[model samples]
Target: MSQATELEAPQAPRTRKQRQAAAIAEAASGHVGWMLLKIGLLAIVDAIALYAAFVLYTASEWVVLGVVVVVAILVNWIYFSRRHVPAKYLTPGVIFLILFQVFTLLYTGYIGFTNYGTGHNGSKDQAVASLMRSAQERVADSPTYGVTVVEKLGALGLLVTDPEDGDVWVGTDEQPLQKVQGAGMDGDRAVSVDGWTSLSFADVISRSDEVEKLSIPFSDDPNDGTIRTPDGRSGYRYVSTLEYDTAAGTMTDTKTGTVYRDTGVGAFTAENGEQLLPGWQITVGFDNFLRAVTDASIRGPLISVTIWTFVFALISVASTFFLGLLLALVFNNTRMRFRNGYRILLILPYAFPAFLSALVWAGMMNESFGFLNQVFFGGASIPWLTDPTLAKVSVLIVNLWLGFPYMFLVCMGALQGIPSDVNEAAEMDGANPWQIFRSIKLPLLLVTVAPLLISSFAFNFNNFNLIYMLTNGGPRFDDVSIPVGHTDILISMVYKVAFTGQTRDYGLASAFTILIFIVVAAISIISFRKTKALEELN
Candidate 1:
């Protein structure tokens, strides 16, 4: 009987729905911990990526990194979660990524197209914010003077000094100076009551707010004049008090009634046309680009530079490829002795410090004292750095030396990957060495190295370091309106505009930089597409 009872009581019946509901509840309970762990990992990755991107100073790079982090987290969650995740699981991340992409792309593209720059540069909102902040800081930090009372009557006069500095400030009772002092401090402490006719301590305390309104007088008179309060009552006036009108953009002294007005230029002025301030900033849109494009001062020799830039890039790519392929072919044979040693020697150019090597090459290329000119061209000066055409050629030659090792290394690996059967078949079919390479090796190598060649071209297009270190785009273009050089590339031209042009035309430089990006991106995209097509063929 006991055995039968135990067996019958072994289990309580449970419905399939109840078991399923219990499992769902358990899965739901684990979600908090699981979600937190996933989010933590994502945040760590994002922080690391953001820090690295910020260090590199890539504009809009943060936006890309953020999207990658969110996508990574959502994908992980979907794969790991036990409970059925709804489409809403990824909704937040997807919306954020889409918004980030759209905003950053539009912003970068717009900035690329606009003249936004420093000193009246940037978007309209940014400009206004910057201006307002500057104004606020200026107002906050302005110097204040202490008042020294000389006399008081129906009219009042006062002497003030910026005790922090030795500048004397004076004002009259009828009209005070525009400057004010002691914003929140004791008003009486800022003033010394020495000579008085009717004013009492109560009057001084009542006008505590007016302590900031006091100014130093700028009147040329030996005896100080008087100041009247706004209520037609008289009070001591500080000399430096000023009247400023935002509408008129003018500041006037109450005592001398001298007025200074903004010229709608960066400077302030008197009513007379005589310049009151020397430094003034003026906004001129697209003018810098126009000058760069059209002015004979820049244009005449710029024409020569434009041609040389193309020539330089072409020669660099051609020479590097030709020399690199030759080396790769020579070294591709496995039977060749000390192959690793030769590879190392060939790669040494890439391993060396670029700037240090560039300087050495510059010295060696010196026409009179240089190794090449002295050894071959004799002691005759060829002006390698000074002559425009010679400078361009010299730059290309230097770049070829610097750039070939990379291509050689890439080609070496690529050449080895080509199946022996292909080359053998080509040779068997009556192909010469040239034909074997042209048909079999070149085609296969291009499938791998074509993208690299395009990348190299893009890099050389903005090779500021090589250009800067070599000739500094020198032999100045004489006919240009502003100072420009013969060998200046678009990047160098932008640099000159931002730093060396008549005005630090940052807006114009920014606009030009955007144009340069468009050109580079277009070239890169075309090359990338070609590489992709080649890969498909392979």
Candidate 2:
């Protein structure tokens, strides 16, 4: 064929199958369904983020609002853009890590520097308002106005009407009284307003606590007094016995003329060193840390707990590892009879939940009418959990039982990983089994297991459940103000300080938590560095 005719010739008639395949490939490349699904999911996520941002803004949490906005923007940018494929994959995990781990650590650090415990948990303005509200008393011969309880958007307000002037007003705790344009009245009393729903007698009874605590101001002026409802039907004017001076920052008692000035330690204090409760949270810097070291109430118990913590962790690790290694070595033999049976039996303690096992042990070891005392010890009472010394020993024994099986599994794996030739060479030499284990086998085993040992130590250090369920950290210290005990570790002590009492000192607990993190990090770093020597054995 001529060159011009060959170039101009039609190739062929396309097959139906080929045309169908081409259409499928084009649809796959477009990814329209996938893109739509992705956009739908993104839209839902953006909606949630926007709602959370709005709530945070209303709460005046500016920093958190900023973070939410930034995260939402980043999420949209990464997923929608073609260039940020890696970021799209990483965004969820990074966001979760920041929200759960990084944010928690940062907030704990912030609490450690602030007076964020009970009675010190709000802003200065809130504290002032609370103080004023708490100091109110009904003025003698106070005028009682007919009132109706109404609710709007979950906020309760009072619809008050004057029987004398026929003037009506509505107010909530946050908003002062304002005249309403339209009202639904029952004679002289206002039963409802335009935007509010009147609550029934049953609803008022159900919300008795709220009704009793309701205090709506008469006007914007603090001196004008507040309208308080006693039984939802009648409102009385109540004025504060203590008047606050904004410029001088003092609260003066109108009756006694006692002045309370701002102490800057989160409370207003009198000249006699008495301070009011429910003060605002303030930055106390290192006061919480200093309280850990110097305060007489906590210092002695803290020192005792610190020493016991180190001792408990070290002893627990050593005992568990020793027993576990001994068992692993015995079962590592191929010629051993019923090896699988024995291995399963050894792992029985680990099969059941650790907390359940602890509870069982607690029951078994009880001093009165317990299994040990009644059945085994001929009715002689042994204070396994009651005596201070016995409690510590009991805790160790229980932990060893609970902890050894894990170490057994780990040691067994490590033992199998070690080459048999090394032990053979040691035996062929004059070295006996003990010498081989100590010199050759032990060092090699540690090359793999040292990191695990360090981790076990850290885990045991903060083993809260075992201590809490086993002893409840009892054999209580009689002299201390805090509810710490002889057997309490630092972590248990922190729990007691932070939550178990009438007064929960969260700031102090955060200080202790930071100290623990520091200690564990230090020990882990040092232990990891020491493990480098074991690596040289290879």
Best by lDDT: 2
- Model 2, residue pairs in steric clash: none
Off by over 4 Å in 2: 1-37, 162-168, 184-186, 193-195, 219-223
lDDT (C-alpha) at residue 302 in model 1: 52
Root mean square deviation (Cα) for candidate 2: 4.1
Using alpha carbons, what is the TM-score of model 2? 0.91
Q: Give the TM-score of candidate 1.
A: 0.59
- The regions of model 1 sitting more than 4 angstroms off are 1-144, 147-245, 248-292, 298-303, 367-378, 530-537
Model 1 C-alpha lDDT per residue in residues 445-469, reported as the tens digit of each score: 8998888888888777777788777
Best by TM-score: 2
TM-score of each: 0.59, 0.91
Give Cα distance to truth, residue 308, candidate 1, Å: 2.7
